[model samples]
Target chain A: MKSDMSTIVKTVTDFLFGFIIIFGIYIIIHGHLTPGGGFQGGAVVASGFALLFVAFARTFLDKKPQQLYGLFESVGLLIFISLAFLGIYRTFFYNFLANSGGLFGMKITQGINPGYFNTAGVVPLMNMAVGFEVACGLSLIVYLLYRGVIEEGEDGE
Target chain B: MKTAYAVIFMSILVVFLFTAITTLHPMGYPGHTEMDDYFIKNAQIEVGANNVVTSIVFDYRGFDTLGEATVLFTAVISVVALLRGVKKDEE
Candidate 1:
C-alpha cells in the first residue's frame, strides 16, 4: 500500500511539472499575441524546474558549473543584440525570418497564415533569445543563493 | 505575554482591514477618451510586422529594447565577477 501511494504521488508530481513546462513554452512562443513575454515565460519554466528539484531533492542544476550559465547568458544577450542590429539595417524591426524569407531564401512558413505560428517578424526569435537569457540568469541566481555564495542581504535578495 | 500577542494580532488585523478598505474605494475621474484606429485599420502597412506587439517593441520602442539589453549585460557582468574569486580565497 505504501509503495502504491508513493507511485501515485510521484506520478502526480511529474504530471504537474510537465504541464507547467508545456504552458511556459506556449507562453514564450505566443508572446507576441499576448501580454506575456520571454522573461515571464522563462521564469515560469524555471520555476517548474525548481519544483522538480525541490520535490526530488536532487542536484539537477549542480551538474553544470556556474561558468556554463554565464556563457549561456552572454550568448543569449549577443543573439538578442545581433537580431536588433539586423533589424536596424533591414528596415527597422523587420523580422527577417517571418515571411517566406531566410538567408538562403528558404521558406520555413510551410503555407501557414502569416499572422499564425512562426509568422511574427523577429518576435519569436527575440522571445527565444530573451527566454534563454532569463532562464539561465534566474537559475544561476537561485543556484548561487542555494550554495550560500550570495547572501539574503544582497541587493537582489 | 498574552497581552503582547493580542496586541500583535490586533495590529495585523487592523493593517489588513485598512488595506482592504482602501483598495475597495473607487477613485475619481473615469477620464476622457479618444478613438484612434489608424493602426488597427492598416497594421500591416504601417508597421510591416504582422504582430502588433512586435512592431511596438522592436520598431516603435527599439531604443527601449537596447536599454534592456544593456541592463542584462550589466547584470551578467556583475554575476560573473561575484562568482570568480572563490578558489583564490579558499587557497
Candidate 2:
C-alpha cells in the first residue's frame, strides 16, 4: 500500500510537470505574438522539472549526470549561437524559414494574416534556444543548491 | 524583554512608513510622449523582427545581448573547470 501510494504521487507529479512544460513551450513559440517570451516561460518549465528533482531527491539525479542537465545546457547554447549567426548572414532578424509567400509562390499582402506556427523569422528560433538555455541553467542552479554547493551559513557548527 | 520587543516593533514601523512615503508620491503619473508614439508606429520597419521585445533586445540593443552572452559563457566555463578540479582533487 505504501509503494502504491508513492507510485500514485509520482504519477501525479509527472503529469503536472508535463503540463507545465507544454504550456511553457506554447508561450515560447508564441512569444512573437504574445506577452511572455523565452526566458520567463523557460524558467517556469525548468522550475517544474526542478520540483520533480526535489521531490524524488538526489539518487534520481545522480544516476546520469552526463546525459541529463549538462547535455541540455550545451545543446541550448549551440542552438542559440547558430540561430544568431544565421540572422547575421541575412537581414538582422529575418525569419529564414518563414513562408511569407504562400503555396504556388503567391505573395502575402499586408492585411493577410499568416497563421500561428509561421516562423516569424529568427524570433521563434531564438525563443526556443533561450528557453532551453534557461531551463537547463536554472535546473543546474537548483541541483547545486540542493547539493549544498551554495551554502547559506558557515560549516563550523 | 517586553520593552525591547516594543522598541523593535516601533523602529520597524517607522522604517516602513518612511520608505512608503519616500517612494510613492500622490500626483506622479506616466507622461504620454510623442516619441513613444513614433516608436510604436515604426518599430516593425526599423527592427525587422516580429516581436517588439525581441527587436528591442536583439536588434536595437544587440551589443547588450552580446555582452550578456559573453558573461554567461565565462561563468559556465569557470564552473565546469572548477567542478573538474574538485573531481581531480577527490581522486
Candidate 3:
C-alpha cells in the first residue's frame, strides 16, 4: 500500500535535493580546477534526483517526465560530441579554447597559483556538456527502472 | 555439507580479496609512475586544466568517455525498448 516514504523522509529530501543539485553543478563547473569532473558531478546530481524519485515514487507514472529525461540525455550527448568535433581543424579533442581570451579562455601563469575559472580552455565546456549528459542519462535509467518495477507491482495488486 | 561448502567458498574469496587489498601500495604513492609523472607535470599546460585526472579523462582519453556515454545510451535504449509495450492502463 505504501508507495512514498514517511513525511519526515519527504521533508528531508525536499530540503536536501536542492543543495545536492547545487553541489553537483559546482563540481562540474570546477572540474578543470578541482578534484572532481563531469562524471562524478553528474553522478552526484543524479543521486539527488534519485532521492527525489524515492521520496515521491507513487507519482512518477506520468510519461511526460520520462520523455523530458530522454530529451535532456540526448541533448547532452549531442553537445558533448559536437564540442569534440569543433576542434577538428586541429585535432579530435584539441584545446581550442585555451588562451583565446574569450569565454572560458584566459592565459594561465606558469606553475601553480590560485586557479582561475576561465583559464582551462575547452575543459569547462566539455565538463558541463558531459555533466548534463550524465545527469540526464542516469536520471533516465533510475526513472525507467522505477516505472517498470512500480508498474509490475500495480499489475500484481 | 552445503553450509560447509558455502563457508569454504566464501573464505577463499575473502582471502583473495584481502590479499588484493593488502598488496596495494599505500595512498598517494602508486606502484608504477612514468606516465603519472608526465601527466602531473604537463596536464596543466597541455590541457590548461588544473585537475590532471579530468584533463586525462576528457582531453587525452576523450574516446573512453565517449564509449562510456555510448554504453549508457545503449542501456537506456534497451530499457525503453523493453518497457515500451507495457501499457499504462493495463498496469
Candidate 4:
C-alpha cells in the first residue's frame, strides 16, 4: 500500500525530526537538573519517530530489522538494572557515585544555584538507560501497529 | 420520561464531580508534608541533583521505576509476538 503522506508532511518531518530528537536527548541527559527525565524524554523521541512513520513509506524505515529495536530495548533495561545492582553492596539503588569525586561526581553548594551537569551520580546514567528503553519500546510499538495496518490493507487488496 | 431520567442522572453526576473538584486540597499545601519537606530539603545534598523529582524517581524510589520499565518491556514483547505473523513471506 502507498503509506507515505504528501510532500508537505514529508518535508516538515525531515526538518523537524532532527530537532525533536535532539531536544529529547537534551531532556534525557539534563534530567538531573531539569524537569523531564527518561520516560518523558523517551516519549518525546518516540513521537518524533512516529512523525517519520506517518510521513514516510514503510520501505523507508524497513532498512533496519524489527529485532534491532527489541535489542535496544533489552540493552537499555539491562543497563538500568545493572546500574541498580552495582550499588547492591551499599544498598539497592544506592547513590554510590554521588559526591565521590568519580565520573558524574561534582559537589554543589547546599542552596539554590545553577546545578552542574557532572553530578547526581547514577541518576543521570539511569535516566539515559530508561530513556533508551522507553524510546525504543515506544517506537517499536508504533512501527508494529503501522505494519499491521499495512499488512491488513495488502491482504484486503 | 427517559429524557427526564437522563437529565436527572447527568445533573447528579455533575454535582458529585463539581463537589469533588471544589473540595480538593489546595496545591502545595497537603495535610501531610513532613515527607515532602524531607525530600525537598535533603534530595539535593543526598542525591546531588538539582531536580528533586528526578532524584526521587531514579534514586530514592527506583524500585517503582524498575516495575515501570518491566511493564513497558512486557507491552513491547506482547506487541511483537502478536504481530510476528503479519507477513510470513517477508519473514
C-alpha TM-score for every candidate: 0.63, 0.64, 0.82, 0.87
lDDT tens digits by residue: candidate 1, A20-89: 9898888777776566777788788878765654454334434545788779877887888888778565
lDDT of 4 at B22: 100
Worst 10 residues of 4 chain B by lDDT: B82-91
Candidate 3 displacement at residue A95 in angstroms: 1.2
lDDT for A7 (candidate 1): 51
Taking the tens digit of each residue's C-alpha lDDT, what string does model 4 give over A5-74? 8889889998999999999999999999989999999999999988888888665556655788899999
lDDT of 3 at A25: 99
Evaluated at residue B25, the lDDT of candidate 4 is: 95
lDDT of prediction 3: 0.85
- Tens-digit lDDT track for model 2 on B1-91? 9999999999999999999999774676757798666656654544333456765665455556656655665665566555432432566
Give a tens-digit lDDT track for model 3, residues A1-157.
2478899989999899999999999999999999998889999999998998888887765534878888988988898899899999998988788778888777776687798898778889888988998898888888888777777777798
In model 1, where do residues sit more than 4 Å from their true spots?
A: A1-13, A56-58, A90-92, A97-115, A149-157, B1-38, B44-51, B83-85, B88-91
Q: Candidate 4: how many backbone clashes? A: 0
Candidates 1 onward: DockQ, in order: 0.15, 0.16, 0.52, 0.74
- Can you tell me the CAPRI class of model 3? medium
Can you tell me which runs of candidate 3 are displaced by over 4 Å?
A: A1-3, B1-34, B88-91
* Stronger candidate by TM-score (2 vs 4): 4
**Model 3 TM-score, 2 decimals:** 0.82
TM-score of chain B for predicted candidate 4: 0.70
- If you score just chain A, what TM-score does every candidate get? 0.68, 0.70, 0.94, 0.96
Clashes of 2: 1
